[model samples]
Target: MISIEIPRPSRRIRHIHIEFGTLTLDYQAGAEQAQNVADQLAQGFPELMVTIDDDVRADLPPLPCAALWD
Candidate 1:
């Protein structure tokens, strides 16, 4: 996981960005799984921006990329 901390204007924590590495499932199939992961994380850590780094999108041949941020 990649952790990024950003500062807010109100002197509070802005948002936390968590990046998960290349997931080895079909892009479409893995989306639901990814959402569930994000939801679970949100339950414990509210209002974070969860991101996945599924390298497949970058590896795919010339087409619009898939959405990995939820």
Candidate 2:
């Protein structure tokens, strides 16, 4: 799985939004892995918005046995 970490603005703002571009992962891993990653991120940035994208293409598969968040 490929992961991208984006830092939120420090200054207080009326609205906070987070956009995760796109994601594709092994079907075998299931949604649990995705949720785990999202959960971990949430713990670090409680106030920051979190978005998870799991629509990955099977045709363009990722590297074999890739590590999460690597």
Candidate 3:
């Protein structure tokens, strides 16, 4: 199995909105917020799929995964 590690959010994250199907999760958080969310959703990974909206950052080069961002 391939592992996907999400970068923990920092203070500047300010806001994050996530929606899937008819379910919507909207929140504002600080460091480690993403980790907490991931832990909550960890149980369903086998059946989960995601659609991401991307805005390329000029400051960083394209990486196979963004896990290193933090």
* Per-residue lDDT over 1-70 for candidate 1, one digit per residue giving the tens place of the 0 to 100 score: 9999997555111122344455222332244445555577678866554754444443333211323332
Off by over 4 Å in 2: 1-29, 47-49, 59-70
Q: Which run of 10 residues does model 2 get worst, by summed lDDT?
A: 11-20
lDDT of 3 by residue, 1-70 (tens): 9999999754543233345668754444432454444444555653433222233234433222324333
Candidate 2 has an lDDT of 0.44
lDDT of 2 by residue, 1-70 (tens): 9999999756211111243445323332234444554577599857555544444554534333425633
The all-Cα superposition gives candidate 3 an RMSD in Å to the true structure of 14.5
Ranking by lDDT: 2, 1, 3
Q: Model 3 Cα displacement at 49 (Å)?
A: 6.3
User: Lowest lDDT 10-mer window, candidate 1?
Assistant: 11-20
The 0-to-1 C-alpha lDDT of every candidate, in the order given, reads 0.43, 0.44, 0.41
Candidate 2's displacement at residue 55, Å, is 2.1
Clashing pairs in 2: 24-56
